[model samples]
Target: MAQAAAHTDTQQHPIRLYLVVWGWLFILSACSYLVDYFGLAGYPRWSLILLFMMLKAGLIVAVFMHMAWERLALTYAILVPPLVLMVFVGIMVLEANYTLFSRLAFFVAGS
Candidate 1:
């Protein structure tokens, strides 16, 4: 049987990947913040603020956190709770919209 090769001394490590991922994450974060800061200008696409925030958060979680490297069960274990909470939040926000707008309308009319 062929023997395995003897282990060599410490191998050279590459810092490029780590630097690139971190740099990309920083850029994404800065861009998202810029969008939010400028959203105060009364632009029509203010919802893009939330979209960019979500995208930046997703990239940070996936890349910096290595969320894509886990098993399916582990991924579900980590992700399902947030998924459930977001669903609940969405439902609550939808429900609250009517109440909020109705109250605002009444307040405006009264004033």
Candidate 2:
């Protein structure tokens, strides 16, 4: 009696929500495939791929993982660290490119 009532009090999402998410996931996947099938090259190709990947990942995390129902602080805790790490990685890549270019320039000039 009490247990049944308590269980019913828990958050319950409709099946339609999951179905819609699944459909979106399928569509996003097809778009991702099309990016490669069309033979897009350079920044545009990689940009589309990454954008689709992030959108799919975001959808999975928010809906499938039940993060959408979680508190804001919890969502931030789970999401922020990875975003910060990605920023740091981008910085490192820029630094590495600059160092490589500088070294090449010095070598060529010296010779």
Best by lDDT: 2
- TM-score of each predicted structure versus truth: 0.57, 0.89
lDDT of 1 by residue, 2-111 (tens): 33343454344358856876787778778767876766544544566676667777776776677766588988998899999999999999989988999999998899
lDDT of each: 0.74, 0.97
lDDT of 2 by residue, 1-111 (tens): 999999899777999999999999999999999999999999999999999999999999999999998999999999999999999999999999999999999998899
- Lowest summed lDDT window (length 10), candidate 1: 1-10
* Model 1: how far residue 83 lies from native, Å: 1.5
* Number of backbone clashes in candidate 2: 0
After TM-score superposition, the amount by which residue 46's alpha carbon in candidate 1 deviates from its true location, in angstroms, is 5.4
Model 2: residues >4 Å from true position, as ranges? none
Candidate 1: Cα lDDT at 106: 98
CA RMSD of each candidate after superposition: 6.1, 1.5
Leading candidate by TM-score: 2
Candidate 1, residue 15: the lDDT equals 84
Candidate 1 differs from the real structure by a C-alpha RMSD in angstroms, to one decimal, of 6.1
